[model samples]
Target: MSARPAVRIVVVDDQEVVRAGFAALLDTQPDFTVVGTAADGGEAVLRCREQHPDVVLMDVRMPTMDGIEATRRIRAGADADAAPRILMLTTFDLDEHVYDALVAGAGGFLIKDVTAERLFDAVRVVAAGEALLAPSVTRRLIGEFTRLRPRPPAPELAELTPRETDVLRLVAEGLSNAEIAARLVVGEETVKTHVSRVLRRLGLRDRVQAVVVAYESGLVVPRSDVR
Candidate 1:
């Protein structure tokens, strides 16, 4: 069998040490390649355009431009099939701007203090087109953000079938495909199919946006107990 292509990556941060550190560590992985590094969001955008990397580890805060704007710009400029998956890096698990970053088109985020293994796993998951929504921190952040700023249910949600709607709710609750399958008494592949159809029908970019829509549209109410 042919070897799988290495996942091209760009590490972006305003801190010199942090940027270099992440790049060096990712380079240690045989399946990953650090194609470039950038000091700020502006530089990050340029590097992404130049390198056309598969994934970008983007710092949420920086001088000149923030990661949210960069993420939006990157998503806007690239075709859906070719756009790099952006993973925002933040100091706080519930960084105030994290919701904005997600809305701006980030696939997911990581706390800056993430372990090397967790970081590697997050990069691989995002590269494979999966959002990091199964993390408790992500669940809490989305739940809290939506609870604090509720919106009326989206009209687009009316398009989903009942089964697809069920999948979306479980997905918003931070359930993995296997977990959703077990809960719904279906095979994992069936759950994957439902989830994919939900994304396609809802016109969502990924699970993150689906979660946002679920909460904002009132399909999945945020629990006050989320923590």
Candidate 2:
């Protein structure tokens, strides 16, 4: 019999209690393993080099080295074959640096008080190469980019066919793949395929980036009727 592959994780936080709590929760799960814990950004980089974790739950604020710089250094070390996705945890107000983290190739951000289930789900999603774009954060991410100068060229919106465009728009509206499939009268797998293609076409890293692009490019607007 073969051993199951574990999802290696590193928890980086200045708070000892938070790090211990997260590590405890993850360690309790059968498939999730805590590879290491770091109290600050410099230690996070050292831990990453040693553990090569699949995901790092990084806090936005830390002493000596903050999460953003740590994320940048980690991403700079990413290879074509392997890269550890950094899931940043922050308080929405003070952590304006999250916008830079997003543009710097950090996978996504989560409010620190998010539920344990959501945290586990985020780990799985990011490990699977998806972005952890929550509905609440999507709007904020869009707001961050409004009127920014010299942004990358409007991502190749034309690459998506009409049906794919429909899927992308729906995703930007905070619809899940299952919901999209139900609305479009298609199999869930079909919706998933369309979403994958849309992300690929636009060179988006994941759903979060796709949603950001959709809002920034005016593909989806917050209507009173929707959500």
The lDDT of each candidate is: 0.89, 0.79
How well is each residue in 1-227 modelled by candidate 2, as lDDT tens digits?
A: 99869999999999999999989998988889999999999999999999999999999889999998998898884661277888998877335578667666677788888888988888997887666665555455555454352244365987779999899888877677878999999999999899889878887656766776776677766453322
Q: List the candidate 2 regions with Cα displacement exceeding 4 Å.
A: 1-3, 76-82, 93-95, 137-155, 223-227
Give each model a TM-score: 0.93, 0.78
Per-residue lDDT for 80-127 in model 1, tens only?
A: 558999999999997769998987889889999999999999999999
* RMSD (CA, angstroms), candidate 1: 1.6
TM-score between candidate 1 and the true structure: 0.93
Model 1 clash pairs are none
C-alpha positional error of residue 117 in candidate 1 after TM-score superposition, expressed in Å: 1.1
| Candidate 2: worst-modelled 10 consecutive residues by lDDT | 144-153
Candidate 1: C-alpha lDDT: 0.89
